[model samples]
Target: MANNQENTSEKKKSEKKSEKKADKKQPNKIAKWFKDLRIEFKKVVWPSKKTVINNTSVVLAVVAGAAILVGLLDTGFLALMRLIYQ
Candidate 1:
């Protein structure tokens, strides 16, 4: 029927329009990503210098403690191996 044909053609035209609209949005995706990144960066709360220094000191102290523990364990294991083998 002519009506069916007209309806089908109209559907095809709308699909083409939608496809073109989607194509136009491709370039905006990168711009939108950077804009969103800038907005999120603005929302970040940075630590103060004193807070940073305190955190850094805590981290270094923990690292030093762990290193000493590992060293002691290593030395004890080596001494045991020497006593067992010799």
Candidate 2:
């Protein structure tokens, strides 16, 4: 009927308006996102291959030293505990 057609027409108009508004905002949103990404990427510190290798070696050495220390402590504690209990 005429009333149904009028309602649909109004709905379509409102939808078109909303779509246009969104279209207008899209560029600004995308521009800001890309700008932020660029700034963050610029602030990143890139390590050289040598630096990376040296850091990795230092970490591994520290981990091995700590492991050996903990193992020795565990063994010594067990021996002391056994002596005390006996």
Candidate 3:
């Protein structure tokens, strides 16, 4: 029927219009995302230089302690293995 054809044609036209609108807004969406990211970055409270240095030194001390403990365990295991094989 003619009415059915007209309805289908209208639906297709509306869909095409929506697709075009979405395409046009794509760049705006990206720009809005970057703007939001900048705003959030401004809200962050960064650590002071002295605080950063203190934390870094603590981390290095812990890592060094762990490495020495592991090395001692490895040496003990090697001594045990040599005794067993001898």
lDDT of each residue in 10-83, candidate 1, tens digit only? 99999999999999999899899999999999999999999999999999999999999999999999999999
Candidate 1 local Cα displacement, residue 62, angstroms: 0.5
Judge candidate 3 at residue 82 and give its lDDT: 100
- Global lDDT of each candidate: 0.99, 0.99, 1.00
Worst 10 residues of 1 by lDDT: 22-31
Question: Model 2 RMSD to the real structure?
Answer: 4.6
Number of the candidate with higher TM-score, 1 or 2: 1
Most TM-score-accurate candidate: 3
Per-residue lDDT tens digits for candidate 3, residues 16-40, read 9999999999999999999999999
Ranking by lDDT: 3, 2, 1
Off by over 4 Å in 3: none
TM-score of 1: 0.73
Candidate 2 lDDT tens digits, 1-86: 99999999999999999999999999999999999999999999999999999999999999999999999999999999999999
RMSD of 3: 1.0
In candidate 2, where is summed lDDT lowest over 10 consecutive residues? Answer: 39-48
Model 1: residues >4 Å from true position, as ranges? 1-20
